[model samples]
Target: MSARHIILCINVGSSSCKFALYSVSGGAESIVAEGVADRIGSSGGKIRVRDANGRSIAESDRDLARPQVAVDALFDEFERLKLPRLDVVGHRIVHGGAHHVAPEIVTPALIADLKRLIAFAPLHMPGGIEGVEAVAARHPKLPQVACFDTAFHRGMPERAERFPLPRELWDAGVRRYGFHGISYEYIMQALGADVPTRLIIAHLGNGASMAAVENGRPLDTTMGFTPAGGFMMGTRPGDLDPGVILYLLEQKGYDAAQLSRLVNLKSGLLGVSGLSSDVKTLLDARGSNANAAMAVEMFCYQIKKAIGALAAALGGLDMLVFTGGIGEHAAAVRAEACQGLAHLGLAIDPRRNDSNQDTISAADSRCRVRVIPTNENLMVARHAARLVFPAG
Candidate 1:
């Protein structure tokens, strides 16, 4: 057996593709290189490939009409690098439906099944499928593994996973399928035994969600069945009452396509503030702009409510972890979310929270609040390595 194995972790978004290469020796893995192809299929499409030390390896901006075009460009860079014999390609797939509760080697049949799931999460699945297909076409001989974002929540109890819809709908597989499981998995791995039994992890980013984890298993999550349903995000509304959708369709003159665009693209922070969807921009403007203040308030309010709900789900909260972009860096948001949750025994140490620390909980707080930077790609690489070589 070879001493070194290369694992390529691919995370494809709606108009972007991020990949990281890792080298595994024995049981340890190290990041070899990583970068992203963004604004895909547009005239302004650009890509940047960087080494592990944050130095640029390759960069480009060229007109394109599809993500595959950008992906093909990536393949060109790979050939130039000629890194090593690739052992496995691990893909980040958003939804696995009721099937695919674990990592599985890619096959045509598996691809077909995943394609059928596109309607469930139309915004995300297509890009992931496109990335997987591109890899299949470019390097058909190499073994590929798919790591699911929903697979981590596979152990959720029947009640938690079931929607209140009719029994027929349940039989037809219409139930809650929480997303962002890979990131959550990484947090659990990063926390290990130090992370108390009952935990609540808030993954705040462009697409945000909160999870109730008891003994390292998911009991419930804020985002149910789709990425758009969760805490308000950069551009996506968190949970909306079913009546809102009905009213929009009947009285607000909204077609399915229009509603999709509004809910998934034009809403959230942008809609709330009537400004940019970026958190940094909102944070800067919140003090002076009423709309920005409201947006920030709404975002924190939703997160606080979710934390309370998850605390109830876990019977009690022990460890509260913050990850992702806003969760890791946005101290104000974290502070705001924990403001009214003191009754739940959660409090953030202002100094530790402001500074970059592993645990941000105050000494007197009953719950251990943490700030853990998640590594979804590393989680994918580790899962892929184990799947490809169960015993090494």
Candidate 2:
């Protein structure tokens, strides 16, 4: 057995690839180096790698046409930097379908199973599979683990996970599969025994979702079936009426691809604002447009409604956790979501909220409002280490 082990955690997105290296010590893992490769395909930019302290160690510009070549360059960087052997590679797969309800060692069968879920997460799974395939080709013997973003919600009750549809659709597997499991799992792990019996965690980022977790297990989530199915996202429409899709198909003669593009790209904050999808920019505006303000208002309203629904699912809410980029930093958005939740005894102290404190809840608030940074990389590394170094 190796005395020292290194784990590489990879999260591959449509046009970006984020990598993190971790080392185990004192029965806990710590990140050593992490970076991202953005704009992988066309007009490729720089590859940035930095140490734990944010010290730049290696960086160079390159042009590429695909993720496979980009991932290959990452391996070359490892050699140039004299990085140690990677004991295991943990990948962030977007969809695992019904088969992978937990992390699994990467095998040919598992790969095939994951491939079948590509259509379910068209924009994400392809890049993720490309990264996995690239790594497998370069390092065949290295143990690899596939950690799913949907697996944490595997335990959702039939009622909560099921979509109200015909029996045939249900039988055909047309149901909700919540994502951002890695982040949700990290929050639960952070809570430990302190985790309340009923909890609602809001993961607000470019692609956002809220999960109803009871006793540290996922009971329901905001994003259902697909990433585009959740609350309004930076660029993706969420929870549109079925009639809208029908209108697009029948009236506009739009196909699946065109509809997908509309819902995933030309919608959300950008669509509403006709400005930018970024929340920070909207917040900084001197004068507000009706559409932008309406978009922001609608966004918060949707989140509040989701929280209420999840609270109902959990019977009651005890812990309300906020994670991800927007969740952690968007004080105004958080306040708006908790506005009418005073009935649930959820109140945020204006001063604390503005300071971006972890605990923003008022002293008398019943619910504990905490802002926890999502460490998906560390979570993936831990899961990979458990599989690669499992004790007999």
Candidate 3:
């Protein structure tokens, strides 16, 4: 366990297998290689592989119509590079359900248990589970770890985790289990003790959510029961009223599956703007399209509202960190979000925001705001190595 070991961390994106090879030794890690097999299940699949120096060594197009196919393509590319022998594998498992609150060794029994929770995270689990199984099948004896995205929020109080549903439903595992643990873990590690005691992390991507943390521990998060419950995503409605759901099914004669698709796929900014889900596209069209302008306004409005609500939950916000796709580069969105939040002593410096500094808030701003990129793949690798080779 003390010797240098190579770990491959596979993060199962919606349509890609993102992997990074890390060399871990003496309690430190260095990147060995990284890249992705993208466009899975599509005809125009692409693969890109890079070496430790961050240079692309292999790039090609192939049929990545399945997880196995995509993974196999990655391996074929890696073979030419002749990387170190893999010691173990780590998977970015999105939902671990009730049983796993930390990184766990992957086993057949555990896989079975994990698949049972797929219905809870329908959009995320199937693809992730497929990637995990495909890797295990390829290397039967290779030690593997399942790092749960829900593990970070497991420490949240019952009051925060529980829904107001019936006791029976709660017992049946219908409760809030926030995601993005891997990203939050890396962010906390990077921030170290300098991180404020009360903090909020806004991970704004196509699939977005926010986390309220106290002393580096998650207290509450926007996502609940499923990823679909969180903030308005690219295509999913956030925090919808139950009455609307009942109305959709009972009055409109929509079935359960159809209702699920409505919220999970056809709603959100796409539904409102009748255009692309990408925020940049919406921003570009805002000047010309009324619907796109309204969509942008709503998106920022929702983020501002969530910041206020989370600040209230934390008693007050000391530091606000933004990550993910939209949180990192969308300065206009950031400005729009912080426009009315100056009342909370959160001021966005226009120059700093535009420049993309690590700290985007004004020097005198009471609540500091930062832009810290997330490294969930590295988090997965660390977790996998720890579980694969436990401390004495």
Candidate 4:
């Protein structure tokens, strides 16, 4: 029998760090443990862990105020639980820019390259980098791989990759580099043999974006340049007019810092509704609060429009998938987004959709609408395993 190898997949978000441990031997794999350090840098933060069968292994309050602290806490829990030593680590890096496309073993050069690209994803890169550095500090010789979220979109055609800017700017790495690529890649893997010829995946979550895939190749995506570009998200006002930014700077005396805060933090559902950034929160209050109602409407409206645009990009739509936190759970959002798309032969059975079934499409609908839960952690682990344990 071959030896089992444990892989730790680390996904560092803006406010949380999620880690999963997978045990792989021979041709099989299973999750041995998983946990998340939530509300990092906030009061009342907690780190929770669970075993393979979803049993709580540990739960405790801690001052997880930074990525390094959270990483140390998780490693400490692993020791307390006496878990097997990890063979490798995988990290979900949000941006790879135009250089680091494929999954690569983390190195000093790679770290330096990532640091240079931090300006492209200022809010996310630091946490990812911190996670990597913290892991290195704890397990000096342990192999770590960086699985880029922008890698899946590297095959996009030049027309789709280019921005309507000066050639010099495009050459200087100013172009559409899609995000949520790890999720999209997982969705495609989950489809396996049944993958469609023309598909659009709407990974709706706190951060939302859509990708148009044709014959398993990425054609285009909603997010351009950064994660903040796609559509309206929980906090980001996606695809804002450049003139609005110019006006804010030239007329309103808004500096770069203030503009970044407004566009990335203060806008979107929370800005529009003057409420929480959570979709469920807005949904619950939509009936009573006009602003909340408008916010929901706007979210759905943008999604519907993006579907049409992506569908056109694919020449047609064979399957429409919804995956992510909001995509998998929020039935109302799905229904509203697909409401007026009958012209594209898309219709959802209300009951199936409300139940959050795997296949929510109406039988007669030409486009197959599905709700597939995305597992980006698993994808990162797979890439790490492939790179680190090639013979396994």
lDDT of 3 by residue, 1-392 (tens): 56888999998867888999999986799998899999998889999888889998888989998888888777777776788889999999999887799999988999999889988888788888888788777788988899999999999999999999899998999999998878888888889987898999999888888999998788889999887887788998888999999998889999988988888888889989999789999999999999999988998999999999989999998999999999999999888988988878899889999988999999999999999988898898888877777761
TM-score for each predicted model, relative to the true structure: 0.97, 0.97, 0.95, 0.97
Each candidate: what lDDT? 0.89, 0.87, 0.88, 0.94
Q: Write the per-residue lDDT of candidate 1 for residues 1-392, one digit (tens) a residue.
A: 64778999999888888999999878899898899888886668887888989999888886546767767887788778776667789999999998889989999999999999998889889989888898888888988999999998889999998889999998887888899999999998898778678999899998899889888778898888788887899899988999999999999999999999988999999999999888989999998999999999999998999999889988888989999999999999999999988888988899999995888889999999989999999999999989888774
lDDT at 267 for candidate 3?
A: 84
Angstrom error at residue 245, model 3: 1.8
In model 3, what lDDT does residue 315 have?
91
Model 2 poorest 10 in a row by lDDT: 282-291
Better of 3 and 4 by lDDT: 4
lDDT of 2 by residue, 140-165 (tens): 99889999998999899998778999
Q: What is the lDDT of residue 163 in candidate 4?
A: 94
Instruction: Report the C-alpha displacement of residue 99, candidate 3, in angstroms.
Output: 2.5
Clashing pairs in 2: none
Off by over 4 Å in 3: none
lDDT of 3: 0.88
TM-score of model 4 vs. true structure: 0.97
Deviation (Å) of 310 in candidate 2: 1.0
* Number of backbone collisions per candidate: 0, 0, 0, 0
Q: Which residue pairs in candidate 1 have backbone atoms (N, alpha carbon, C) closer than 3 angstroms, thus clashing?
A: none
Better of 3 and 4 by TM-score: 4
Each candidate: RMSD to true structure? 1.3, 1.6, 1.8, 1.2
Q: For residue 228, what is the lDDT in candidate 2?
A: 93
- The positional error of residue 58 in candidate 3, measured at the CA in angstroms, is 1.7
